[model samples]
Target: MNFKKIIVSAVAIAAFAGFTGAASAAIREVNEWGASAQFLYWSAQAPNYLQNIGCYNGGWTKTGPTSKYQVSVGTCANGDTFIFRVGEKSSFDGPLSVMGSTTDPNRGSIDPQEGCGDANPRQRLMTDETTCSGASCTARKCVDITVGASDVEGESFTQVSHGMKYGPSTATNNVWIDRAFSAIDTSSLANTRKLVVPFGEFVNNTVTKNGVTIDNLTRHQVVQIYSGQAWYWQDFGGDYTSLPITRCFRHAGSGTHATLDKTVMHSPWGGALLTDESLVDPLTWFNDSSSDLMKCINTIDGAIGYADADQIQKVGAGQTYPNVSAVKYNGVMPTRATIANGEYDNHWAVQNCYYRPTDAEAAAVCNAVKNVPSSKAGFWATTCEMTYMKDKDWTYPVYVGATCEAGPSCSDGLDNDFDGSADAADTDCQ
Candidate 1:
């Protein structure tokens, strides 16, 4: 007999003997639930968190025929699955569960609101450029080719969720909000509740053209750079031989932009150092895409910019940007410990989940969605801003929020919220 026949016969014999092998021996099957959601570009780390919770059997699979944003699919063990798409938070003005084709007039094209011109470009796969078919750039459409009902295999996965880094108030004023109007008060419109959790911080980096790097910068120096007060590389130090300090920033609708402005640029008296002339400088570039922003920094000499620390880890780790380095703020490097302990005073961006109040199906999944960090033991004590963070000993932080003892014996001054008075002396004990 052939070796193939002999192998098949051996496998058949094992099956007949009721032998159960490793999990990889057979295909894993699932039949529980599925969902689809659209979220902000900064939260690109979200898929990592989802995959860690076993929501996906193996890992996330990237799929999308459009360049406007990113799309990833996760297949669960119960036959349930989910799809995630990345876009500016402002563009998502409706329910997280809205299902439509890539060709639909509203959902089909990237509009001018996202800093692209008003030509209404079609979505490319991974590039940020719009599609134009005609000679005059008149015929433009998104190029996404994924088509099918939101449901898979004729069965429906009932839960849908939407995520963003900013709150509804900020989302309303952004020109990219794609709803008929930018009102986020869903109390009258649908079943939605604004869920919030402490998110991650952003870190600004001072990169050189090639030879050298600036290790740290004071808040005042950063303000001067963005405000046009510091225009040349020599202004900070004679660290590099490059001239013309290049400043790059995210476009106006970005959540990172808002956070930077609030934390780094704002004055003590409710003012800003960046003037109109500085913001509108021809030399500066307002990039709308994070990848594009990184590319800009990598390609430009003497370039300086800010991005989510987690985002930088995702791309800046082993990719391009060989000449660039992250700046330590006030002698402290950006890390989960620094941010958690409030050592790094800037870049505390948040993660929010919004769903319609009437959508009970979406609401059902809120626990798994909101408790992403705490769900995994020692994953994130009270944060959901990154894929994962370990302490100095490389272990998960101990979570003491709900699990903290609330009664008389539990009161300890060292533990927060326990009231300094220990034992029965603390009101918490009573």
Candidate 2:
């Protein structure tokens, strides 16, 4: 598979975000579409922060499979309306658009809009005065999109693109809130499968459940699925009728996707690395937004992917994410208790705001997001609340405090929780 084509598709899909066909008049855009921020990490949390700080429709949803996953448009307090596009583009577009460079040389200018030849009209154009065209394109007035997002951070996307350390954000232009990433799947049943590692190739073929044999989706199995080693549910003992596993993935530049690369494929705690996300394009399915990915997974059986867990729990217009569910990794689930304590730490992300410093409106929008503490929004991965800490992604965590016994103390033969039974016998330990 051609790697460059995958990036081109990411930019194109972002160009055609879900809002272009929205049915809500109340949330109809008024900006006449000035140059939108090329990158936005958490579109789900943008509307509220923009609304509280002042984008009017900040909370309005442009319909999608679920209102919760739809794009948000609002007239902010500053009276400027900005639309934060949903899905994977936010992470993909941020670094390239802000720095004005492209990884693809054939696409165009040395720094031309992500090697796509010309600047993407919607990404860099800040004002309605001129469109991006002509022999030499004008520099875009970077629009800042400050959002309190969950799951993958725009900075992590930058880290993958630049190969930088994951602790501090490589893209300083992007501000952040907090978030936690989740490894997801097509069915809730997948969660209950007894976690087991495959010792050899083709071992999944005979594995089963209920005194019968079925393949289990261990972390190692997930790495295989994404890396093209496992092609169908039958390949791993899953009972799903579908053949040829559908790898639902966010586009090349998505922070969620990048985090996926680190959390599973190239992870420090891993087997069978996914060398290049685009390398497995033949067996993969891509979506630009988190919502779209949900739809993709829900529509297809035997499909697996990852996304911001916060959005997975959200409901829209009496609708919830149906058929799609997050599964446990190595017997541990991605919950606040497990994630913060280092028991379920893979793909835990830190979010940040991304915008052009020159654009005062963008800065104001980001400032609005900063005012809302991550704690208020629920499960935004506040470091102070965590019992374990780590310096970079793909590295196991170190116990930072003793507040939670779920990790280590759960096994100490004594009564760690004073309830009588200790070790594996205690409910708290369980």
CA lDDT, every model vs. true structure? 0.37, 0.40
| Model 2 agreement with the true structure over 222-261: per-residue lDDT tens digits | 7878777776656655454445666666544555666666
Q: Quote each prediction's TM-score.
A: 0.49, 0.49
Off by over 4 Å in 2: 1-88, 101-216, 238-243, 267-282, 314-321, 355-378, 401-430
- Give the C-alpha lDDT of model 2: 0.40
Over the stretch 1-430, how does candidate 1's per-residue lDDT look in tens digits?
0000001123223322321223333322111111111133113433543354334454443422333344444654454444433433222212211222233333322333332222322222221112222221222223321111110111111111112211111335433321121212223222221111122322224454245456667777777777677777677667654457666665443444444555566555333434221223324655544555665576666677776554434434465555456666677766545554555654443333333344333333332232222221111123433333222111223332242222112324433233454544543223
User: Which residue segments of model 1 deviate by more than 4 Å?
Assistant: 1-62, 67-211, 237-242, 267-282, 314-318, 370-381, 384-430
- TM-score of candidate 1 against the unseen true structure: 0.49
Question: RMSDs, each prediction?
Answer: 15.9, 16.5
